[model samples]
Target: MNIRTMPVVAVLAFAASCSAFAADSIKIGVSGPYTGGSSPMGASMRDGVRLAAAEINAKGGILGRKIELVERDDQAQNDRGVQVAQELINKEHVVATVGYINTGVSLASQRFYEEARIPVINNVSTGSLVTKQFLPPEFPDNYIFRNAANDTIQSAMIVREAIDVNKYTKVAILADSTNYGQLGREDLEKALAAKNIKPVAVEKFNVKDVDMTAQLLKAKEAGAQAILTYAIGPELAQIANGMEKLGWKVPMIGSWTLSMANFIDNAGKNGEGARMPQTFIQEPNTPKRKAFIAAYQQAYNPPNGRIPSPVSAAQGYDSMYILAAAIKQAGDTDGVKIRQALENLQEKVDGVVTTYDHPYTHDDHEAITMNMVVMGQVKDGHVVYANAADKANAVREKASGKAKK
Candidate 1:
């Protein structure tokens, strides 16, 4: 062969080899903040995703191809998350993604996936707007789906817990400045409005703000019988500590972030009795949950053999299984096909959180709803059902829901 022709043939051969290697494994992007303040949730979620992938790959893999996770730590920053999203889509060519611990990060990064038609299963981000960013009037297809409880449901639960259950007429709203916190605060307001109650004071604090004296003082002055929060673990813990300093002990009812290990550990006894919505507690009430807890404990060996963030870990594990089920049903790794399969999953996916069956639709993308969520309280360094009544109510609600057989 001619020398120039030989170089061209060699390049072609290398290209073919690259294509074959790519086809041998399915790349799924795992993007989350593996460090910084949100690391408890992010790291636990990532470990859960890893565990699910390992389990699937062990069972002859999905559709005869090994699952490859391309993990990128967004560091809980929106800009960094955008960069990771672009890299995962344009460079790594991941068919799907399954991690977003931060709402701002998910909102900023998921647009790229929507544009590229890549499916993103948000396992941890609870911003109400995260899944609804792309709609029919503006866009024909939405590539984003969520397995965690959205703030809408969580806010309603919080409101009910405070006003209806605890009978707190005066409440104050405390939220962080980020998109997650702010949006959750708004949801809380709307939920309160629906109940014909207004917050005594609405306060905002930036992330990493150790001193919540001003916020708590305002709430105290306003005679807030309850302090409703919509922030992450670290900041929430600060609020509990600040309240302790101010000698103000009010019922802390808020979003699901209260269940995070960072908050529990940082706030210590001050964080006790903080109620929040939880999709899954660490307790193994079911066979699936027991197995998942054991697997996660053996895999990560977290403190006291408890998962750091049980809700995040369980949601992450279930998100991976749901995505894998979709891929298997689709019988291919194409993003559009995967999205369609996710929207129309025929088989029931028994997840650690709940058994998912047709969890999505063309218009609605939220998989977990209010029915699956239960009120949990921090007790003795762990989150558990606040009472037997709440647990019984949650079980009855789940039994009455449309969970597929």
Candidate 2:
């Protein structure tokens, strides 16, 4: 869909930006799956990046150079992501990059950026190893950074939600065979072990697998009180639907992917009560969130006015600002300088997800922490705060300058 409307203020600001933009613009790469099952997260992330770029460009961009986004669809494949990374780095000559929806894609691809000394901000991919690909004693500097909540945080939250919150002692783990799923599954196991518990049943499936009957039957036979998941949207929906077919329903607690629109719509009533940790729910709790939601609605005019992946969009939006802040602080588009600026950002970023204050450092490239996430549950086709207390806490956090939008 076309942009429904552009705010008059933005129109004027963008018009002013035109003259400030030189013929050579600051190239930033946007790489993700714009098609296929993972499209919801990828597309939402791209849209958020687009929104942020527009706003930045409207304000005459960073360092008085218009921000130019070079987008490519990796189709959620590892090899494709590698190729996309190389193209962006070598061919397009992008100073920095953002957007990696799949953990496998980020793992397979981000090495190129490290080798080239180009900064790559992972806005969606949450694999714990993503930012640790290069460390001291081996690689002098790291170029890979992330704004998404890593699997370590998610697995802990999932286990806590199932065991501590819901009181489910016997939980089943259903994870896809992909790197994202397997790595997350391992993290879940560790989290469970920490709680002095083991999964009643562990099941694995492929990417496009539709029938989860075998997995569900095994979980049911094992007397699992809940199903912990580690997969993307469509397959997660299959698990919910599979339970429906078996006439047995158990609470589904998993990663942020459970908030995907595909699962919510595909699972329908069956998807209700599913909970996951979210960096940004689609609620207009803070001023930044309200403006972001309204801007997204006006720009893309998405179906149902619901972002396919709220977490993806918010993180992607924030990633752009983070990169821009670094660029502005450095006063140059040099990759190495940009990376250094990212590690020690003097300016606090006012973003849709949260207010970033010293979000990164030389030893830590992860921008998100456990406190930044909250449990969100599916309710009548939308993700809402699982606990009323979380909603209040979120608002309070925003007011306190720790969170917003």
Candidate 3:
């Protein structure tokens, strides 16, 4: 028989025969920044996902199937993310897809997956607008599921910390004009209003702007005792630098975005004392977290390069497993079924960040919520717990309230 006339099973065996993972080969897709201003996050996310897939394979795979990751570089562009997502769905025939950590990229490609019936497990995009805009009629399948906490839950947690715990009364709001920033600011506003608290000063800036001294000065002049901001790593660092230069010292709190390793290193000593919520903290090593950190450190050191943010890696790692779990639950590997399985997931997975419980649902696409958020302060260039007692209180509040229930 001619080689071209070989049976489909023979062809698959020939393709995977060399690797010895023939009977249990499963393909999945991961798309992210890969290149661009956000490459640090993208690359880290990629490493995490790859690491998880490796571990999964080492353990005899999932349900007798070995996982194969098909990576696509979106370069942080939503349009590109959409194109790449389609490619993964149509060409690669991926069972499920994860990533597009940037909110813009996630938002741009969300509808594409919905139409194609491909489920996406978003690792890090936190813009609440995604959960709002692309729901029900827009995407009946609600194919979008996230491994990160939503802006609303994070905002509510931050407000509670600033008011009830930190006793911060005159907060100044500084947010960039991006989807994540805008959504976080709106959520903050609503949360504060519920507590009958008002901000002392509200300042806005574009994400690309370098100088925030004027805004910091305005907040200082307004007697702002605490600063709550919504912006990316670079801009957040710039704000911290500007605040120090202006000799303005105040309690700082904001979204989990600031916990990224780059933010602290870029901000230098000024970044110390900055309190931010985080889903994963790389300290006080649990066996699982320690193993993950060691593998990542090994993978990207010496002969390898350093990863920009370990948190992104954790996000990517967790997101992949969740997608895999959903795929397994669906059994057939059809996108629509996998998406529904993701929405109705019930089993708990021990993610690098934390153990996520019922990480997804139909009414709520936000996987990690307020209760999963932990407060960390940048100390000695490392993110450490901020007053263990206070952290406990915040977690308790999140649990007792809407977050856990």
Candidate 4:
């Protein structure tokens, strides 16, 4: 070849090599309780995130680069959550953040991200504190976004379902002392008043408490015909068992987190006949759900190939997809830009739980809604759709006339 042709070929070869060698991996930080008391819920978060990262990478990834999830075990502690988030933001230098099931941990760590200007794509923390920036004069331009349903919105739906749908005259509120449980109780009260109904009792318990007999007895004495609660992991099972042991057979409601497999396996038959609002439930036959279930089974199933908490896996999967979508939309991995893209997500996200339509916005930080939270009852050791739930939803809509548009 001529010298001129050789130079041109070398330039083209160099450019091609650079293109091929250009790394496309963008790191996203995932923190949850991989150990300690909240491990079941944390495992779900971790599994879901891994599956999502895998799916995105398999599909050519975001911006021709693969997505990498930097996972850490927070052990469900506020201090640990904060420390892990710092490592992700500073040491790992991830483009964005996700995970953290406990609100206390999420709240504790949010300030750091806000100051660092790194966006947090929160999947599990439901405390209104995440939106503390959006309140009044403190409106933040960008910082936090959530894919999971918030307690206020979910609890309001629970109360509406119980009073308007279930037609229960008297209800009880049983919640842990944490922000999640307390907010759930408060929202239920407001929803009750809005519908001209009242809860017969509102009781509180700690996260470590195993015996809720006294609390259940108090609620029963107050003429509570139905129970609505917000407690994570095995605590929820303990409450269900306590209620059944006391022979209270009324309809019960709680957070979608109760759908975790551990809660059902621990509560066993007692968990049956109980109802909880959920954003995603494994359906009959869908490619997405099937793939997720299959992956989880391969990783964590027993000799019988039985899996415990599929909900956690589903959440982790969906959260990662949502984060990837935001990153793709941004066309760059800057945390602030990604956060904006998430808030302005206008397209439909085919999540493991459901198809999210215009799920987030500047006006609303909480994405999932009552439509996302379908009421499911434990029947024959599986969570099945409650009978006539659609009819009840129609009644709720007619009664409330559409939640302020």
Candidate 5:
């Protein structure tokens, strides 16, 4: 009999065989906004995770089981994220999960993992409360850990850069209506308050808002020298475009979301010189970074050889390695054991971002700190170090801290 005309029972048997073969592999859920405005960050992060998983599996797999990613697109919606999280935990039976590029999604989705005791490594989500949702007082053990620089650190850096470095006294705060943007706006306000400075005008906008005329007008009327933003890329691009239309050009300093490809590409010339804190710039400064860039390029050929969102990609790559190390240390895929191992990682994990040494503990789940971050700028369609002095100072501080340790 021709294979194409196989019997129905034979086809079903072949499909069952494939499903059983897949079940033998260790499953990891990868959830993010893979097909929406946030796709730049989400897709880059997913690509980074895939790269690390491929590398790990090539080396005899992790704990003798091949790693398989069960990806789900959250579409940057809170309810969709919750559904994806439940499906990943219950149906997919993923031992652990990684990839949450949107803060709103992270906050809405991570509860399922906490309830199920499944470990989750948030690779790109920078919400301050993402990992703090379940603490010792509330819960016996927290199952969520993040590798990205949280909004607290990013907000402080942004305030410092605007006031201290650029000498902008009258700044305006522009944030979105989402939970991430609103919470980040509060953080920015607190950071400014610490310096005894208040924003000239505080404005809010919704996601996918094309016109930022009112927001820009308010800031311009308030004589704001710079604009501090907390929204994602598409809306951020609108801010830049609106500024250009109004013939008002001010420094756009904001969170790391400003480094997204969507913002840079959409804003075009208006997006140039925009600054933000970055955990990783794709400059190949270190040997590890060089190798990672080369590998990512080889695996996924991005535009102009750029890794789309460098910060997201690097954090995602490092997060996977950290998870692999924890899984290796635990010697099993048990969620509780994995959580314990992550809280106290024994070996040094040389990742694309930095050499993680005791990155987490019982009280702290933040892996990347302020010292490991540097100011990055959008220049010539790419993100680069904003200034040599800032980069050098951060490097020295990181090195000094490591020496003391």
Candidate 6:
């Protein structure tokens, strides 16, 4: 109950006095950075998972077994993620694990799950290669699945908004030095290359670094029309704040991390007009979304009534339901059976993000795609639909959850 420095959570404590129920409970691992700069995304993701697990447990649970979440705070560090992965797999003996907010941590830690055939659904991490690490032919059997939109989809959308919509000819790339940033930067470059455009300036900075004057000045000198970013919340705020200091104002287009509360709150009005691709916004465009928003608001009572990272929370919520459906379909908690069931889900999971119907396949592990993503712009204080049409058509699109393009 005491929310301390790292916010360690042992969610979903069921009736422990009942020895039979305790033995019948299903153990699942939830790993992410519950503290530090990345906590906005990580904590939001874990909370969403908690909501889903509580709902499932209340409804006679999955396969009549209560869902027990074994939580771990990875602290947004790669080495810590590796250690957590091992503990979750070995000591905790989790059937499946969910939540990986950082790409570097996902890459470093997911291998242990792969080795154990334990399903690890990356609820937040969007590195292009996160799901491709254990593809067929190379590894025969793969254990990774992702519900979040990958960098390939996000980078392409970022370029489309930058080049096609805004018609910006000269842009600058500023990405963090972490695996998430560098890999996303590469994806952005590839996306730009497809349009035969190269950035005027490409700069890199480390996480928690406040000063971005050097990077912004270089982009300013190059007459860059906009700044393309691939980084997390806190540092991203610095870019906007730094630009204000140099009196250089330009459109900030970047990955979904631009929507994080840390960036939006820290950058203040400076963060306004920033655009990024998002799978789920805070808006309740559908019935499921309305209920989710209301439930999350009532349970967490987050500041300003906004989930810290709405996309992360929504995707995390959907991932839990999807995984639960797989467990039920598999008729057992065996890791291999759950993995097989996930590859071919029989039921339609009515999730906050989308109505997932057989969302994954043996050949493809990614559940969300580019068509499900829409450009969200920071206006006033929160993210709003960049185009009203996207919101108007949300119900029909989400109902089917099919790829249009």
Lowest lDDT block of 10, candidate 4 = 391-400
Between candidates 3 and 5, name the one with more favorable TM-score: 5
**Pairs of residues clashing in candidate 6:** none
Residue-pair clashes per prediction, in order, are 0, 1, 0, 7, 0, 0
User: What TM-score, over all chains together, does every model reach?
Assistant: 0.92, 0.94, 0.85, 0.84, 0.92, 0.94
Per-residue alpha-carbon lDDT of model 3 for 1-405, expressed as tens digits? 211132334323332442454544787888888775577788888878876776666565666787777778998776788899889888877777888777777777877777777777788788877756567775565777777777777888789889988888889999988766777898898989999999988888986688999899989998988899888788888889888888877877998767766677789888888887777776525666666676666555512233476668888988877777777777767777787788777666777776666666787777765666777787877777876754443322113234544
Cα lDDT of all candidates, in order?
0.86, 0.89, 0.74, 0.71, 0.86, 0.89
TM-score of 3: 0.85
lDDT of 5 by residue, 286-352 (tens): 6677777877776667889987888888888788889999999999999999999999999889888
Model 1, 1-405: lDDT tens digits are 211122323323422343344567888899999999999999999878877776776566699987778889999999999999999999998999999999999999999999999999999999999999999888999999999999999999999999999898999999999999899999999999999999999999999999999989999999999999999899999999999999889979988989988999999999999999999888877777777787777656788987889988888888999999999999998889999999898988878887787888887788887767888999999999987765654432232244422
CA error at residue 202 for candidate 6, angstroms: 0.2
Look at candidate 3 and give me any clashing residue pairs.
none
137-213 in candidate 6: lDDT tens per residue?
88988899999999999999999999999999999999999999999999999999999999999999999898999
lDDT of 1 at 206: 99
- Model 4: CA > 4 A from native: 1-24, 132-136, 302-307, 346-348, 388-405
Q: How close to the true structure is residue 16 of candidate 4, measured as C-alpha lDDT? A: 33
Task: Say which prediction, candidate 1 or candidate 3, comes out ahead on TM-score.
Answer: 1
lDDT of 2 by residue, 260-334 (tens): 999999999999999999988899887778888988887667789999999999999899999999999998999
* The candidate that achieves the highest TM-score relative to the unseen native structure: 6
lDDT of 6: 0.89
Q: Measured by TM-score, how close is model 6 to the native structure? A: 0.94
The per-prediction CA RMSD against the true structure, in angstroms, equals: 8.6, 3.8, 7.0, 8.8, 6.5, 4.2
Candidate 2 segments whose C-alpha is farther than 4 A from its true place? 1-23, 395-405
